[model samples]
Target: MTAERIPFNSYLALPEGKEFSVKFKERFPFSVNAFGLNIQHNFSDKYYMAPDKAGVEILVLGHIYDPFSGRSGEDAVLEIVEMYSESKERFYDILAKCSGRFVVFVGGKKMLEILPDACASLPVNYFSPAVVNDSNEFAVSSHAYFIREAFSLPLCSNVRSLSSTRFYHLGIRHCPADMTEVEGVKVLTPNLSLTYRAGELRAQRIFPRSNRLERDVNEVINEVSRVLLSSVDCLAWFRKPIFCALSGGVDSRMTLAATVGQRDNFQFFTFAGEGNARRDLLCTKKLSQLLSLRFEEIQLSNVHPSEEFSVLYHGLQGETRAPNVKDTFARQQYFGVNDNFEVRSSISEVSRSFVRRKFHTAEMALTADAMVPIYKRVPFSRKWHELIRQEFATWMERSSFRDVEKYGYDWLDFYYWEIRVGTWQALVLQDADYYTNPTVLFNNRKLIELMLSAPEKYRKDDTLQVMIMSTLDGDVLKTPIVKNFGKKAWFREILESSYLKAYQALIAR
Candidate 1:
C-alpha cells in the first residue's frame, strides 16, 4: 500500500487483514484515487510515492450502490477513471448519476456526499473514527455509539429526540435525521444532496430534481426493471440470491414484477408489525404464491405502544427504520444485510393517491402541522416543521425549487422526492441492512422526473400503479389496501383530533 499513516488501524477492523491509507491532508482524512486504489501505512512498510497521475480522490464508508451497470465502490470508480482524466464535472456526474445510500467524502477542488454514513448514523453531530479518545473533541463516525464509549462520557442529552414525523426530514444543524408526509403528493427526495469545496464559503452545487413528465407506465416499468437488474448485480456482490424486501404495497409489488425472469434467483421477505403490515403480510403471501417464489414471513408481536412503535410502516422512531423488531432480529442476522445486500422499493409516491388533500401553497406544504392526520399519532415536531420551512426558503434562494409551484405539482412534490425519498428514507434504513432502491437509483432520474411531472389526473388515485401492476397480475390488485383494509368509524378522526388538542393544552399548562 502506498499511503501515508494508515488511519485508525486498530480501531477499524477490516476482514482478511486488508488495510487502507491515503495521502490526504489531515483536514481531509479519507482520500483515495479513482480506482478505489488506497494505500496503508504504519511508518514501517517499504513504500514509494505514487507517480503523478490524473485521477479523482474518494473516501467512502460502506458500499456505494451505483446505477451505472452493477459495479459499486472502487470498481465503479475505476471504470469512470478509465473513461476520462478526472475533472469536477466528471466526478459530479458519476456521484449524481450512479451513487446511492452511502457516506461519500469526495476530494479534488470540492467534496460531496449523499447521506454520508458517518453523519447519517448520527445526524445531529459530525462523527469520525480515531485511534485515541478525546471526550470534548468530536470526529465523524459510522457508529456514533462507539465514540461515546471511547470518551467514557454520558449518552448525549444535548440532542433532542426526533419526533416520528421528523425522523428523516432533513439533517438539520442539531437534529438526527428522521423519516414523514404528503401534500399534493409531496414526498422528500431522500437522495438529493449538496457539494462542498473546502475553502468556499458556500456549496458549489445542489443537485436538481428530474422534471421530465411522461404518462407511460411502460417507461416506469422498464426503468424499474433496469434498476432491479443493475441493483441485483450490485447487491449480489455482497450476498447471494437477493431477497426482495417485499410488501403488499405498490412499491414492493412493482419491485417483484420488475424482476420478471429473475424470479427464480430471489427469496421474498415480508413482516407483520401489528397494523397495516398485518394486511401487507397477508397480501404478500398471496402475491408470493402467484409468483411461485419462496417467501419468508417476519412477524412482530407483543404489541404495545413504546417510543418505537409507529402507526406508519415508514417511521422515524430511532436511528433505524425499526427500533425494536425483536422477532425479526434473528432473521435479519441470518440474512445479514451487512453480510449481504438486499433491495427494497421506497418512494411509493408512484401515484398521487399518497397525497390526501391537495396543497396549493408552499407555506402550507412545509408549515402545516399535522400535515398527515391519520399519522397524527406519530410524534410531531414543530422544530422539524420549522426546519422544513427554513430549508425550502434556503433551497429556493439557491436552486430551481423556487418556482416549484409553477409546475403541474407544487413545492410538496419537490420537497418529498428531493428531500424525503431522496435523503430521509435512505438514511433511516441504514441500520437494518445495506439496501438499494430502484426508485432512487441515480440512473432512474428521467423515470422519476416523468413520474413527478406527469399530469395530475394520470397520477390521481392508484392509476399509475394499477396500470403497471395489473399488466403483471390483475388478481394482485384485488388485495385489500393496508391502511384502508378495515373501515374506520366516521368519528374516529374527530375523537383523535380532540384528544390530541386536549393533550397539547395540558402540556402547555
Candidate 2:
C-alpha cells in the first residue's frame, strides 16, 4: 500500500464504449501500448500472487473473509491453481466456497489477460465498472464514474450514452465482452469475461439446476437459517458488535429472524426523524421490541442534506449521485461508529421486488428491458440498437441464463445483486466500514445456487423469506410494509424526476 500504488478513481478506457473515444493519456499520466499501459499508483492494501503456477497476481483492496476454508494469501492462490487444473467448469464452485469481499487481480503468462473476480465488492459503482485488456497490458476500473471523478471528463448524454448508462446500471458493463478489436486492444466487460488465451470459457451461473432441497416450508426455513447464520460467522469481525439495518419490511425482518437464537452479538437499528417513528422506523421499532433487542433509532431529522451529500460523494467516490438517498449513507456511517461489521439484507428483496412481482411482457417472457427499470431512454439509431442487441446477447451468455422462461423470469434478482447491491450499496458500505450481506460475507454459493435454482413458485411471493420471519415471530408477518411508492412516495419520485433530467432520467427501458 505505498503512495505509488494508490488506487485511483477509475481506469482509462480508450475508444470509450460505442459512442466516443478521447485520448486520456493527454490529460492523465499513462502510456497506451498495444498490451496495456502501466499506471503504478494504486490503492490496494494486500497483493496475492501465484508464482508457482500461472503467476497470477491478486491484489486485495478490501477484505477477504475466507474463514470456513481456512485459506489466506498464498494458500488461496494454490487452491486456485488446483481448481483451474481440475476443471474450468467448477472454477466458481471453489471460488464461492472461499468467502470474502475483494476486487481480486489474477494475471500472468499462463493466463494471457488479468481477470478480476466476477462479483467484485469494491472498486464498484451503480453502473457497470469496466476492465480493458490490450495486446501487452491490462487496465481496469469503474468506467463512467472513474472518468467523471478522475479527469473531470465531460461525457456524452445523447441517446447512445444514455442507453449505455442505462444498460450499465443494469449490470451490462460499459465495454461489451464482444471485444471489438481496435488497434489490437480489447476493451472487455467487467463481469467474468472468458476470452483471452484461456483454454475455455464456462459461465458460472448458467441455468438454474433442479436442486430443490427445500421441498417443504420447514426445510426452507432451516436452509435460510443456515445460510444467514453461516454468513454471520464468516465475517472476519471476531467478537465485534454486529450492526443490522432493521427495516419494518420482510427483507430486514427475515435477516433479523435468522439471528434468532444467536442474539448475544446482535443489535437492531432504525433510521427516521427526531421522534417520528413513521414508516421504516415505526415498523422497525415494533419488531425490535418484539424481538426484545434494544431498538436504537437513529434520528436523521437534525442531519443536514449537505452533510449527507458530502459523505455520499466521498463514500462512493462519485460512482452514484443520489442526494435523495445520501441520507442512508450518512445515517449508516453515523450509527456505525467503529469498524466492527454490519449486515444488509440487500438482494433479499430482489427475489420479490417490484420487477419480479409480475412479468413485464404480455407473453410472460423476460426481455432485456424487463431486467430492471432502465431510466432515461432515448431513441436508438440502427447501429445503436445493433450494439445494444450485441450487448444483450453478451449479457445472456455471461449469466448462463439463456432462457428466462425455463429457469425463472426474475432476472431482477441477478440485476439487483450484481449491479445495484454490489456496485452501489456494498461498495459504499465497505468504504464506510460496514461489511454487507451473509450470502456475500460467507460466499455461500451453494445456498445462493439453491435459492436461484428453486422453482419460480417456491421463489415467488417471498415464500422463503416469509417462512423464515414467521417461524421466528409470526407477529412480524403482519407488520405493515413501509410503502416506498405510496401516495407520499410519488411526490419524492416526481421531485427527483423534475430536479433531475425529467423525461431523460425518468425514461424506463
Best by lDDT: 2
- C-alpha lDDT values of all predictions: 0.42, 0.45
Measured with C-alpha atoms, the lDDT of residue 365 in candidate 2 is 36
Name the lDDT value of residue 209 in candidate 1: 30
Per-residue accuracy of model 1 over 248-281 as CA lDDT, tens digit each: 6666666666566556677788865676455677
lDDT of 2 by residue, 1-509 (tens): 01121123233432222222233333334332222223321222234443445444433333454443656544555675566556754655565554444444444434533333334444322112232322232234443343343333333333235433543453322223222112212222224433333333233442233333434546656665665655555443444567776776667766676676567677767767633465677777776766678668776544554543454344333333333345544554465434345666655654454333432222223454433233112233344445544555566665555443355445556554444544444344433432132223323444555455555676666676776667665666666656543356556545533432332234323
Tell me the lDDT of model 1 at 273: 69
TM values, all candidates: 0.60, 0.64
Task: Kindly report the root-mean-square deviation of model 1 from the true structure over all alpha carbons.
Answer: 10.0
